[model samples]
Target: MYILQTVVVKQVLTEKMKRQLLLSYEEQKSQLQREYEQLRFEQKKAEKKYKNSKKESAQLYEKEMQKRLDKIQNIEFQVNQLSLLPLGSELKEQELQTMTEVNVGDRWSDIENEKTIIIKDGIIIDIR
Candidate 1:
């Protein structure tokens, strides 16, 4: 499904907001790091536990290990994308779809989403 994300206003970013966003990003990145470490530890633990278990238990733990690996991959992707947030940029994401009508705006897109569009004066602005 397509979701409308990332709204940016022209020249509204302030130093204080930028600092706050940086701090928030730092915290989130650190949290992700900690989660990644925990996942690694759990994967190792599972490996050791299943190393000598019966065939059935080995299969079960192998599935569990795969799940952990997938979760780790997802978290890593999120962590990497965290750095790309428009924290200090001119654009901020439109968190809600309350903007039913706009006069003129621009449109752009990213890797997963399409078209950052701005509408103003009943006209669509393609900013991408």
Candidate 2:
């Protein structure tokens, strides 16, 4: 009877140890699963943030390029205006001596009375 009791107690202890070990393993697995879920959430958030930053960067770059293009167009227009001025001046100088003198009591001719001149789009016009 003493031997039989000892064996029964040993079997109970072994079963308790197995149950505890199984519970410990389950707890560890649950904790690791939670950690993995948290890591996945953080990664998703980081990816969204990165994508937003990239889009903003691209928009900024496009705006900068547009501004540069506008500036270049303005400079080109100014250069074209500057280039036409000398040619207009040379033409006006050639015509200076050919202008006929008109008296105050003349026939009021349209060609002789025109004085104010304007140049636009490379065309010269006389404005009275």
**Distance (Å) between predicted and true CA of 82, model 1?**
11
For candidate 2, write residues 17-51 as lDDT tens digits.
Answer: 33453465556555555655565565556567788
Model 1: ten consecutive residues of lowest lDDT: 95-104
Runs in model 1 with CA error above 4 Å?
A: 1-11, 52-89, 99-128
- The local lDDT score (0 to 100) that residue 118 gets in candidate 2 is 43
Please provide, for model 1 over 27-87, each residue's C-alpha lDDT reduced to its tens digit, 9 standing for 90 to 100: 7656656765675676567677777654666566467656656765665675566556554
- Quote model 1's TM-score: 0.42
C-alpha TM-scores of all predictions: 0.42, 0.30
User: By TM-score, how accurate is candidate 2?
Assistant: 0.30
Model 1 clashes, total count: 22
List runs of model 2 lying over 4 Å from the truth.
1-13, 52-128
The global C-alpha lDDT for each of the candidates, from Candidate 1 onward, is 0.52, 0.44
